[model samples]
Target: MQRWPVLLFLAWVCFLFFAGIGLFMSGFLLTRIELASSSSCSDPLVPPPWERQSLPPGSCWAPQRFAKAVLVIIDALSFEFAHFNPAKTSPLPYENKLSFLHRLATSQPRHARLYRFRADPPTATMQRIKGLTTGSLPTFIDVGSNFATYAIQEDNLAVRQAGRVVFMGDDTWEGLFPKKFFRSYFFPSFNVKDLHTVDDGILQHLYPTGKHGEWDVLIAHFLGVDHCGHKHGPDHPEMAKKLTQMNEMLRSLVDHLGNDTLLLVAGDHGMTETGDHGGDSEKEVNLCCCVLSKFLIPPLPLQEPEAVPQVNLVPTVALLLGVPIPYSNIGEVMAELFSGDGDAVSAALQQLSVYHINAKQVRPTVGLPIELEKRRNVFLSTDLFCLVQVGWGHDVIFVGSLH
Candidate 1:
């Protein structure tokens, strides 16, 4: 070979080596980023909006009236993802179907509610999870170690009130709740060599025959889809394969549970190409709620049919449980879903709004008084309340009261 060709070939090989290295490093960092901000279950220092108040048991109104148990699964879910893709993603063909997911999305007695939020700069699993569990976004951007903290700690008065709560997932599941509270069953993430075995352990515990009414609240996190998405992007065949597996697993469990148990299937956060989150990507997060029982409330009209966001989820689940909507939750309960009675739900929602506004008015304990004034305009602009103008767009001031 000529000296020049040899040199060129050598250079090309060196370039390819570094390029491969770069890609691997990027994937590693992306995986770590997703796990760090999105998957951890502990609450951050500032806490999210929903985590602001711990409702004393039975403080609001509704408590375990509609359904006996609650099941929450956060999909590769972004608030923006749900807003963008209201219709279901195209399903795989017969041999490749996600039977459980497909059934949940399309079946009767299974109502799906899409919630839209007014918050800006939406992104990340932890933030969305905080919003779902608490009713508001996290006060600070980087708070919350995982979803369990929001479920057990924070202001999860509903979970506390439940007769029993069971959480199943990877190692992160262990961190979401305090050991003293709900009985937690954990499985390591799919990245572990024996991921399926861990899942089996969980399924066995949850579906042990002859064991009835074991748990009042059950939250299971399936990591296969999320893991595959992170490792191979959302559109990849591997991702779809994992989703199919998850669907099958869920369907089997649901069949085992039968009518007495209500199955809720949802995603924690969605993923985009480039394998990264924390930005307002349309695919960053999307969640779907599928109720397995015939007793669920029917669907309700979407306020702004065009702008479906994710924060609406908290209110929907609260309504399903017949729990009084908290004062801070902005979304309305699907009136159609209530068993021919919406008065109590409506009244409870009003009270929740009152509580939210009242809570905001209280002086801040952590920040300086001057800082509060500086941020007043920003706070007022939030979806929590609006400043109205009389006559012309002048003499603007906050208006509206629940009482």
Candidate 2:
């Protein structure tokens, strides 16, 4: 071949390779959705607290149920690990380990609530954490960026609370919310074999910070369970050991927390039988959310426990902490947590009204405002009287789902 022809062929190959790389990068960048933040407290899209009559309709604040909150994330805590099944004569190694949660739910029925927390697909830690904080679902492509997480741009629970957040464990959090926490003790989370470093680091600071009242929202993300799951599948003896450690730590933490401090224990995601997660398998998606506080009322126990979306934790935490709901939140305020005695009708109506604000915040993205309006009107016209009579406050939230 002539030199000129050989050089031309090499040039063409390089051009094609670069073009393909450019196209692949562009595809992910284009499909990646970045939601606009609510920005200022005065933004029209933000909702005012239920009690503040002086503030306009769309303003900052929501009813604060607790003066402070401590969110403990036990990574990869599957429902089976946390839920106790009386029917199972022979339980697995991971099952019935976190028995304290069940005991708490039974002993303090009015003060504690437990739910099967269901995660959206792409249940990587970073993605699940994003959903847990932002009240938004993750795209499938987001899993690719699990290790290389960028700071979350959208208005999130951590940023809403801002300088009041104290965090430790899972350096992924630092990557996800850089400079957001008032005080932080980050431990490298990528080493699956080394579990105790992150968990112990969190323990060193978690209770001391909570006792001192230096933070309005204390966040501790434990990685031992997830690390154990990754290193030795959920069937291993190490899994039981880790869960027992978690149970003991939780009991001590509960004793340490004051009545005014709300403690939210959540699993960002779960693992499969083989201890792999990323996909949308039932075992992978089903996790646990145990909310403990003197400020809450437990829902009536059902034959089969109901599951709540993990993203719902965002609005639930935001409202419980008296912060404005994020602009992109799709989850409704969990009514079971907010239900109380008093003027039942008035309370139901007041809670129902928050759905209108939720609906408005989400309306712009769904692109079916007219249809949503028509469906909402139909619900109001047909079921308003029935809903009021029966106090079906949750049904009103279903109406907001029209968006």
Highest TM-score scorer? 2
Off by over 4 Å in 2: 1-30, 45-59, 87-89, 140-149, 296-305, 364-403
Query: Which window of 10 residues has the lowest lDDT sum in candidate 1?
Result: 31-40
Candidate lDDT (C-alpha), each = 0.46, 0.72
Cα lDDT tens digits, model 1, 1-403, are 5999999999999999998877654432221001121111121223234445543453333334355555646446333322322254774221234444544444543343433333222455555555555444342322234643443244442353344676766555454444733667677663632325455555567565313646656776655555555666655666556555665666566655644455555555555665456565555543444445535444443442443344445555554454543333333343334434356566455445434432332222443456333332222221223333311112343353111
In candidate 2, what residue range of length 10 has the lowest lDDT sum?
A: 383-392
lDDT of 2: 0.72
Candidate 2 per-residue C-alpha lDDT over 107-156 given as tens digits, one digit per residue, 9 for 90 to 100 = 88777767898887678998888878777665544322244656777667
Question: Which residue pairs show collisions in model 2?
Answer: none
